[model samples]
Target chain A: MKMLFKGTEAIAEAAIRAGCRLYFGYPITPQSELTEYMSRRLPEVNGTFLQAESEVATVNMMYGASCTGRRVMTSTSSPGFSLMMEGISYMAGAQLPAVFVNVVRGGPGLGDIQPAQSDYFQATKGGGHGDYRMIVLAPHTIQEAVDLMNLAFDLADKYRMLVTILADGMLGQMMEPVEFHEMRDLRDMPQKEWALTGASDHKPRKVTSFDIDPYELEKMNLRYQATYKKVEENEVRYEEINTKDADIIVAAYGTMARIVKTTIRMAKEEGIKVGLFRPITLWPFPYKRLNELADTVKNVLTVEMSYGQMLEDVKLGVNGKANTPFYGRSAGVVPTPTEVLEAIKKIMVGDLNGR
Target chain B: MVDKAVDKVIARMPKSLSGKEFTYCPGCHHGIVHRLIAEVIDELGIAGKTLLVAPVGCSVFAYEFFDLDGTVAAHGRAPAVATGMKRALPDRIVFTYQGDGDLASIGTAEIVHAANRGENITTIFINNAVYGMTGGQMAPTTLLGQKTTTTPYGRTVKANGYPIRMSEMLSTLEGSAYIERVMVTTPQNTIKAKRAIKKAFETQIKGLGFSMVEVLSTCPTNWGMTPIEASKWLEENMTKQFPLGVYVDKTKGGN
Candidate 1:
């Protein structure tokens, strides 16, 4: 049905329609709407929805429900997501598949419940432990919020990877039009060989990563690294605009990326050739694609809702091929499209003019 | 007929066990509790289908001894991990083997709420009144007047404090279906411990609710005593502080 839904609600609805049977979560600001949405909708489809005592409990519940091969999910914000780190680490170690939605807020420690991209490092750099990686999707708008959540579940199950849907408070709180889908049946899905549901007489199944020998653990970590490489090779995803002949390129993600889209359009109108590269998958990051763009663009300016977190990746992608600069706003202040356009103008002409 | 019954009862244990002898110190009650859990798994014939969650204590390497599907959890977080395991495979038998330090100290919240929610799982709690895994240290169950490395000059009532009665504490919750406190001081008590373990498993099989069996175990190495002396101490001092017998058994009231 066509209806205006908040980004958090849309993501929750998309998860519900993706045959998700269990939703465990603790309420937090900028994302409580998602839990509220699930609380109302999950029961209608005979699904389980639990408001866990805390974020820690919610994630563990997600771990438990996911073990049964049920499509399970949890939603929380920055501080809540921090509490869930231990569970996330266990999920990765167990090779369990589940979706986690982090509606990002400013934080070193509960900085504010407002929108922030400060979790860039935590999400993309293996937030928990034990040499593991999770599939992280950065959604820029309400539509992408719904779309990425479904894709998150799909990637999680297919790769036995923990998938994270990361959006900041802006997208989570903003309302936009979205079309919902009827839930799909998981019965026809490929059988999960690693799950401990039950061992038939045919063969016994086991799920663990407790080998104590250093060499064995090294080999297990090597396998995980190889799988991460494959994901990086096969799953690098992004959106590009006006890159055919551009001197300056702007890189951003999530809420900032969406704002940069409009900024790029305005930059083009001003006769200063600037393009936009918005990464969709923050982990298995679109480095190769950005590297290719770096060869063509004169300078790359990375913008974000936090202080220059993603700029480091932009520089890594460019690798001295292009001049990389950053503009950011932290502590709950979201930069406008005009602010980004102005920053681009200053970078193009303010210093090292036309270099 | 007596020989036949005896033969059936004295059968060999399951092959799913890791076969490595346990690393627990002599006079430690972990071995007795482990044997009891193994016997219960044997009797139920669910060892093949059971997924055991081991805690980080002296028994962290329990996965090495139990011949079944087992995973080791972070200290005190075994219940949290078991919660996931049980939810994932509701049909499979899932149980967490944890210690007093691992459960009552850092993981108290997870265990309490999981029980309060009536999660259909089994928790085998080994209360040794001290932390045996990490040198001799005072545990939440460490009795007043009991001394350890962390509690010098004995655990004072006003200072180091009284021992926690987990079985009594957990039995007060409405969602808990079966809560029993058993002692493994002798072979006769060991048999009763096995029965408690079996009942906790049966509760899950019947989809009753949360079940826990807290075993009063000895830690002779940590207590600076021989294995026999530790068992004797458990009989004299430990039993008086943490009494044996079921604190709460609600299987008849359960589904």
Candidate 2:
């Protein structure tokens, strides 16, 4: 049976079910519920939950736990997550596996505590220094958010890279029915041998991102790029609704996609052929699939809580094969289903991207 | 080969100290402190299970110098990292080696919180009064009226703040089990520094709480002084601002 669960709490429970026994977090809006849930739930399972002094501390703490070959995670909001950029880069450089959740909010510096996707670029791009890529998971529903927890941890471990759940205040605060899967018994899985348990009976080892030699560092970077190529090849996920005979397709992710789902139903009821293409992995981006889907549609309207951040990707994917128009609400504004439907109606009547 | 009576193995390079040659600048105390930590690890027979958290600076390559599992943390973030490691593996001995800028400045909140929580970990803080890796910028521990690259005309109280006494400041926290200020300028002080490091580790082994040893060090290259002059400068000027003594010792009930 499914039960009503808040998005933030469901995400927390899902991470716990995914064999994450260690968590370090600092409280922030929208996502504070997840931190609070972990603070209580972790102890019940005999897991470690440390409220770090700051996001910087939390990320390093997660890195430390990751070094031990233990599954660890942390959650924060936009401003707080910005402080973790350096640690994120370090984790990527060191090839450490850890999960980070950013329930994004308005940004560019202390943007209010409202939902926004302005961090789309920051999440998919290497927010920190260096040529590193983080596997970003964007979930449109509470159930999907919960379901992706396992994949998030597995991908991090599989790629030996950082995996982040890109959420926002809208989805973080919304409540919906969610059914949890069985908890994973980590004992049944293979342990990471490269973990920093100790050097007893073996040679000493180290896990570090620092290499003074530029040549050696370049080699490591090349290896990371290779791994990213493999990830791109293997981990592209997306959802297509009503695209079999649709004239217009809506592109979005996370909270905005959920809102677009409502718009999809409203549009279909009005006998308008509108489809939705929601990206699950925002970094790998499902660009190939999106391009294929865009080939079938006449126009693709990209919607977001930010001013067309993901629109850039949609435009590239469509490659002018379809009209790639954008509709978004910025600075804590929640674009309603009606607003999105109106935008779709405008697209049906005229090309919004007629540049 | 000499006869058994003709020679005695009074001392040798510590087994835990790896074969890596010292990379620190001349007159720097990091190499000696590294040996001290290795010697203590050897003494305790924990070279196999100790996890070292290296900080960002000249000693950022501490993982290469020690014969154990180790990792380098971002600047001033080592204490927090060690907290996670120790918490994750309760049986493992976790420690951080950090510099003044890393610990006393950028990482102040992390270190204080780690100490306040009584995290079962150890810290070896290197206070060289100047940011060694960043071209000798004035550190939080840089003495007032001391000239650094950033403070070209000698630090003034009106502009740059006075040297921060981290050991004294941290010892005041209730969760700290051990906190000491030591220097490695002289042989005697080096011995004392090693003793402090060992006691800090013992405190962790005893499951007491957070333990730290803040070692006053020299930066000859950055200080524009010869090795000998650097040692003298540390002894004469650094000690004046940061006293040498134990500030906290919960193992002995209190200090």
Candidate 3:
């Protein structure tokens, strides 16, 4: 059954359904509703909810809870997310599973509470102090955000890495009908022998990001690289619409893709033959599919709520095979459908280049 | 050689210890404290259900020293980590071993907030007045008029600031169930320190509240003194600045 739910609350409910009982977070705009929801709802299900001292403590708390082999998650905005970068890096290195929801707000330095995709580079390019990648899922709608929380948790545990739900402020605050799957049984979760349960059943178990010996650390890095490679191979997800017969395929994600879809219809009426390709997984970006599209399509246009962060991946996919043009707005600006159509029209007229 | 006829085991290591040789400096009290905690866990028979959260200072490798399941948290984040562990597994006993710099300085916010919430966890705070792991750097618990790497000319009220008394400060917070300050300079004091640590854990086991024991430790390597001198200096100078005793006792007050 579909229920009318606010975006943030739906994400919280969906996480509870996904067997995530331990949530540690602090309030931030556009995402505070999620934390508030967990605070009220978690206790009904015998879950743990804690408002940590700061985002630094919040992420570290999640890290600690995750070590006990329980599902954990948190939500924050841009500045708070930045504070969590250090802990996120540690979580990634320690091979812990956790989910983070960044209801992205204007950034660079507390620009505003308005929606923006400014944290794309920070999310995809390892914002913290090491070589790590968080499987970033960009959900365009509230229902999708609800659904991706399950994927976020599953992928996090499966890969023993971080998975982030990269939603902008618009999607976080927007209301929509959301449907949840059956509740997951935490008891059904496979036992992680490596977790620090106790020494009674076996020898002492240890988990840490610390491998002081250079050679031992290198070996751990090699193992991490293997997991990342496996993720890249099997977990690429995207949605392509009207792309088979289109002359131009616009690459966008998150809420921006919703606008691009409208632009696609407008361009269709104008005989532009524009298509839409929305990446569901932003980190394991649908690069190979875009490469194939470049072979058949003449122009590839990229639209974003930020200043062309994901465009780099689009460029990497095409690799000089086709003309890549970009149109982006930042600093809390969401480009309209008409503006996207205009960008598509310019790409068709050969007046734009992917710079 | 098994000398069952002539020898009898009097003082032996606790089963909760990992049997690994400690890497702490000579005369360092971390070794003594580690044994004290292990003894408490052994006595309580909670080794199978106890989890240790090691800090990022000299005890960063403390997870390896304990037979209990454990992990290492970043510098000054042990309180938060312990908070997570205890909240997730309330049946499992959770504790953190932290240094003066880890608990009093960088992690002050984490420790205060965790205690303020009354998390059911234990913290073993080693206040050696210097950053032991980082090569004798000045710490927030460094006594005034004492010299160190950061406060080369000696700690002063104006230049550096007054040393933090964590036990007294945290005892005031309603969340804390038991808070105590002790030292392990001599045999008598070591026994008293063990009592304090055991009481702290007992507080957690009783589901009382947050518990901690601030141990006044010696840093002979950093203080430019011999092991024996460091112990004597702790008794003479450190004891005057930071007194030893129970600061809070919720168990006795029916709290």
Docking class of 2: high
> Candidate 3's residue-wise lDDT over B1-255, tens digit each?
545755777777899989999998888889999999999999999999999999988888899999989999988999898888888889999999999999999999999998999999999999999998788888998999888988889999998779998998998899999999999999999999999999999999999999999999999999999999999999999989899999988988567
Reference-based TM-score, model 1: 0.93
Stretches > 4 Å off in candidate 1:
A202-204, A350-355, B1-10, B14-18
Per-prediction interface RMSD in Å: 2.7, 0.8, 0.7
Model 3: per-residue Cα lDDT over A1-355, one tens digit each: 9999999999999999999999999999979999999999999999999999999999999988999988999999999999999899989899999999999998789799989999999999899988788899999888889889988999998999899999999998889988898899989875778887778898889999888899999988888889999999999999999988887888999999988888888877876777888999999888999999898787888899888899999999999888888999998889999998877776677533341
DockQ of every predicted complex: 0.49, 0.85, 0.85
* C-alpha lDDT of residue A255 in model 3: 93
**Candidate 2: tens digits of C-alpha lDDT, residues B8-75:** 67777899888788789878999999999999999999888899999998898888988889999999
Clashing pairs in 1: A64-B84, A67-B88, A68-B88, B16-B67, B17-B66, B17-B67, B76-B102
Tens-place lDDT per residue, model 1, A28-140, is 99899999998999889887777777887777767666666777889899999888888888878778889999989988886888899998888888678768898889988
lDDT of 2 by residue, A246-282 (tens): 8688998998998988888888788787888989999
DockQ winner between candidates 1 and 3: 3
Off by over 4 Å in 3: A351-355, B1-6
